[model samples]
Target: MEATKRLDATEQALMLITELSMKHGALMFYQAGGCCEGTQPQCFEKSSFYLRTGDVCIGTIYEFEFWLDKDLFDYWKHMHFTLDVTEGIGAGGFSLETPLGKTFIIKYRLFSELELQNLEAVRINEI
Candidate 1:
């Protein structure tokens, strides 16, 4: 059976990503577990942010990597994540989309039993 993807993106989010990528060259996403960002997804130029040990590349959107903190991955690994966009700046104002008056967010749903069984394996420290 083909493996199921752990992540996806909304149309609006994709459009925003395209815009950001064109402006920033390449992009990457990191879901901050709980810090000054308060558990929000942050977008940065691929080389701008540092990936910590054991961070998981859960999936990609528009050829851009989407990462989760190792602890966050362990907690949400059974769920499917949908990348989304919303108006207004996020709490941290550190993501690429912040200056554009939008913020990337995550909408998630639990994976089905079959999906869990066939879910794609995540990459560790691959960023």
Candidate 2:
């Protein structure tokens, strides 16, 4: 059976990604789990954000890598994440979409038994 992707994007998110990519050159996402901005997904110009060692790259959306903090990944590794967008500035104001009044978000669901069995493996390095 084909492996199921650990990450995906909503249509609105994809459209915004295209716009951000056009304006920012290239883009990437990082979801840090914690208090404050930690709970929200962050979007950045590809080379702008410094990735920590052992960060887990769940997958790609719009050809850009989507990453998660290693500790957060440990907590959420069994779920599938859907990249989304909302109408508001993000908490930290660091994301590219913030200027456009949109913030990247993550909507997740637990993997089904079959999905878990065919889950795509994650990479441990940043792009």
Candidate 3:
């Protein structure tokens, strides 16, 4: 059986990624650790932000890696994360898209038993 992808993005997110890339060159996504808005995925210009040694790269969008803190990954590994966007200034506004009045949010659903068996591989410190 073909493996099920662990990540996805909405149409709005895809279009917004294009717009952000035009100005930022290359981009990446990270689900920052903390409460409130910090939990939202933050988009950054590739090479601008550093990926720590144990960070987990759950998947990618348009060649950009979607990363998370390892501790965070343990709690979310059983779910699929769909990247979405909404209007508003995200907390502290660190994401590249935040300045454009957008916040990258995740829509999640638990993996089905069958899907869990065929889910794509996840990596740590590897792209």
Candidate 3: residue 69 Cα off by (Å) = 0.7
The TM-score values for the models, in the order shown, are 0.93, 0.93, 0.93
**lDDT per residue (tens digit) for residues 13-100 in model 1:** 9999999888999999998666566567889999788888899899999788999888777788888999999998747757889888
Residue 35 in model 1: shift from native, Å?
A: 4.8
Off by over 4 Å in 1: none
lDDT of 2 at 21: 88
Instruction: Give candidate 2 regions above 4 Å deviation.
Output: none
Which tens-of-lDDT digit does each residue in 1-127 have in candidate 2?
A: 7899999899999999998888888888888866677768889889688889899999999779998888778889998999889898747757788888788888989999989899998999745
Q: What is the lDDT of residue 54 in candidate 3?
A: 85
Backbone clashes, candidate 2: 0
**Native-structure RMSD, model 2:** 1.7
- Count of clashes, each model: 0, 0, 0
Displacement of the residue 88 alpha carbon in candidate 3, Å: 1.4
Candidate 1 RMSD to the correct structure: 1.6
